[model samples]
Target: MQTTFTPAQLENPHTAHSEQIIRKCVHCGFCTATCPTYVTLGNELDSPRGRIYLIKEMLENDRPADAKTVTHIDRCLSCLACMTTCPSGVNYMHLVDHARAHIARTYRRPFMDRMIRQVLAMTLPYPARFRASLTMARLGRPLAPLFAAIKPLKPFAAMLRLAPSHVPAKAAINDPAVHAAEGPRQKRVALLTGCAQSVLDPKINEATVRLLNRLGVEVVVPKGEGCCGALVHHMGQEDEALGFARRNVDAWMRVADEDGLDAILITASGCGTTIKDYGHMLRLDPAYAEKAAKVSALARDVTEFLAELELPLPVNKTDLLVAYHSACSMQHGQKITRAPKVLLAQAGFTVRDVPEGHLCCGSAGTYNILQPEIAATLRDRKVRNIESTAPQAIATGNIGCMTQIGSATQIPILHTVELLDWAFGGEKPASLAGVEPRVEPALAAAE
Candidate 1:
């Protein structure tokens, strides 16, 4: 893991930071076992250890990203399972992120690849554009198989397949407004009504707002707070990503300064991970650096925030078995392993853990759309493990995981908060209809 960056090369902030991360790697290769790409593709270059070497070579030589390096890095899911598996505490997430930014700066992709990446960057982070694109996708969805036959058109095919048939009307909860607590307001926080999640499934936000309000927490959907930049950030669009971070910082800081906020809650774990890292992401900005750090301190996943509350007994307890599919961002990126499951259990569902839980479901932001073949492989594997648990429904904290897994399985996939909200007297999820709850005699007697 010894690096040969010149003192001049080390002078660059990014290179210096990556150097620190690279130095921490002891070349143990423990990451290979857990890396989804390495596990599936069996390519050494596809693993964390392999990519570290490629990154080091590219940086040390101060050359543009070669095809080989770009290919391996592009295949990476950035699941951060390697970070969890590494005994050396290598910050693979930051290192990989730095590598991606470098690739964005130097690598020039093919014509189709460039167009697809550009289209994603332009649309996916904007709600109106994404919604419109979905409308158009329905037309192209019929052509997915035709697109799949051509090599360059595969991403479009993947996108068409993943687009939902029915785009629900935008939820009122996403409007830049406030929902007061149902009772005495104990806390107030801003909710990140994210870009894709808002457009894709506003019900998740609706469920979140309802549950938090019922629990006596005031939720604000702040104006000017748009995407968390995670969608483009992973694509190596550094400037665009940082622009998103700064705008969100301004929006959240305005709320914090004027109305005061107990926390900045995020229902999407992917956004939660990026939002929590605003401190590091904006560390070099003179004006935003301190404010960004403060905001990061206040950022919390909805489950992380809810776990601290004194949850009441479920208003309607049932012996519902839930196979909890921990999103990669939740378990590995943010290291939030227990809160969601603990919350589900307290809400009276029998929470079952999925086997091979540490692996990614291949929904690492835009990874699925960009790398459809490998994404399908990992998704199928994840679905198999999840189905083996024999649960009445699948519960996850991420909209991406819900979509990716739901498309391939019959089990009703729902956000964890939705299930919690339903258990605590809100309306039951429509997807859960006809899903009979098992009766546990001892638990029924206790109830």
Candidate 2:
């Protein structure tokens, strides 16, 4: 794991950080055991250790990224599961991010690849455009089978296949306004009305606001806030990603300065991870550096924030057994393990953990759309593990996980806050419409 960076290379901050990360590797290959691609394909290059060597050599040589390195790197889900498995504490996230940024700058992708990546970058971060694309994708969905026959068009086919049949109406919660607490405002926080999540399922944010208000927490959807940049950041669009970050920092920091923020609450764990890392990502910017650090300091996942709250007893407790799918970002990236599951259990649902919970569901932002074949493999594997536990439904934190897993399995999937909100006397989730909540035996005995 010894690095061979020159003095000139060491001058680059990214190179220096990656070199430190590379040197931390003991070549233990513990990461291979947890890596979804390696577990599925059994390729050494697909594993974190293998990729680390590729990244180290690529960085040390200071050469343009070749197809071999790009292939292995592209296949990576970036789930950060390897980070969790590594006993040496390698920051694979930062290292891989640096590698991706380098690839985007140096490696010229194939025409189709470039076109698709460009399309995703331009479309996904904007809600209106994304919704329009989804509507168009509905028409294209009928051609998915035809597209799948063509090798290059397969990703487009996956996109067509995955587009929701019906998009939800945009909610009032998405507006830049405040929902005050029912009685007294103990805390005021800004909610990230995320790009994709707002477009895909508006109820998740609505539920979060309702639940937060019930807990005496004022929730504000900051006016200028947009995408978390995670969708493009992992794609190696460094400038675009950083631009989104700066805009968000300005928006949220303005809100913080005027209204006061106890926490910048994030419902999407994937977005939460990136939002929480705003400090490290923007450290070099003299103007934004301090503000970004402050923003990251204030950031918290909804579950993380809620776990600290004195939640009311569930007014209408359900006895449904929930298979809690811990997202890779939530567990490894943010190190939030128990909050969601514990919250579900406290809300009177029997929460069950999926087997092989450390593995990725292959929904690492745009990973599923960009690499459909490998993504399908890992997703099927994840679906099998989730099904191994008998549960009435599935509860996950991120919308990406819901989209990926729900497409593969029959079990209804919902964002954790939706269920929590329902349990605390709000409307029941649509997924549980007909499924009756189990009656307790103690109550039956009394009857």
Candidate 3:
């Protein structure tokens, strides 16, 4: 894996990073065994080795990527399972990210595909826009069959089917600033108000706040913090992603300056993974680079921080079987392998591993909406594995995995923080009661 980069190409930061990653690979096929696409499709082009070759050629040639390369790259879930399997220490996450950004810049997709990607990039990262879209999806759910009749709109229709009917009305605040019921607090953390998570399940954030406060960490939901840009980044909208990153960095930095923040906790694994990489993502930016690095250092997954604190466990132990679906970002991307399960066990739940836990649930940010066929296949596979575990409830760190798995399985899907919250004295999730909540009636139809 040698690169002969031109002087001009080396001048570009992304190209230089891509070149370094290319040189690290020795064409070892070990990563293919754990790659979800290769495992499912049995196509070499879908494997890490194949993708590396594709990316190499695409970058080396400095030409717009052809449809074949775009197809193979698009098929990737960006789960980063390959990184865990690779003995060569190849940075597949960064490499694939560079490839995605290249594709978004150079590739001209078909009309329908472009439309879907555009809609997702425009809506998913904005809470207000996503909320409005969900309402429209609910009203339009009855006409799903009609929408499905059109080839271009079928994916949209399927995505609509997955939408929850009633999202929590607003973000929840559970710290001393908002909730006085919680006694003395030791640390004050600002919770990231994720774009999709806020609209889809504000309860997850509510659970996060409660769990943190119970652990003596006062949670703060800063007024201006918005999407973590994870969705747009995966879609290869780097500018939009970085813009969101800078805004968050500034907002959190302001909060830190004012109140002396301890850490920024993120409940969603995908967002957590991205926010932690802000230092690298903005390393080249002149103005916000230093600020981004500082903010990135302060970001932590809820479980990661809680595990470090050695928080007091709940005395009441419920004999509930739990299937832990480790989000790809948490396990592979962030290299946080066991914190969530260990936290669950300490909270007194029987945690079981879902088979093929390394595979993505097809909710790779905007992946489900943009690539429905492949996404549906992967989601079905994840659902089947979860069913095999025979667990009373399913717990995961990322909101995307929760929703994706929830759509495919009958068992209630709870955020890892939610279970932690419940164990510490919050109410049990309604879905675990053997009856799914009727608010998302469309989900009932999905079952």
- Total clashing pairs for each candidate: 0, 0, 0
Candidate 2 on 377-446: residue-level lDDT in tens?
8889889998999788999999999999999999999999999999998999887898776667898899
Residues forming the 10-long window of minimal summed lDDT in candidate 2: 431-440
lDDT of each: 0.93, 0.93, 0.85
| lDDT tens digits, residue span 263-317, model 1 | 9999999999999999999999999999999999999999999998998889975
Residues 33-132, model 3: lDDT tens digits: 8988898899999999999999999998898989999999988989999999899899988998899899999989899888888888888888889888
- Which is the better candidate, 2 or 3, if ranked by lDDT? 2
Superposed on all Cα atoms, model 1 deviates from the true structure by an RMSD in Å of 1.9
Q: Which consecutive 10 residues in model 1 have the weakest lDDT in total?
A: 311-320
Q: How far is candidate 3 from the true structure (C-alpha RMSD, Å)?
A: 5.6
Against the correct fold, how does model 3 do in TM-score?
0.93
Cα error, residue 340 of model 2, in Å, equals 0.7
Ranking 1 against 3 by TM-score, winner: 1
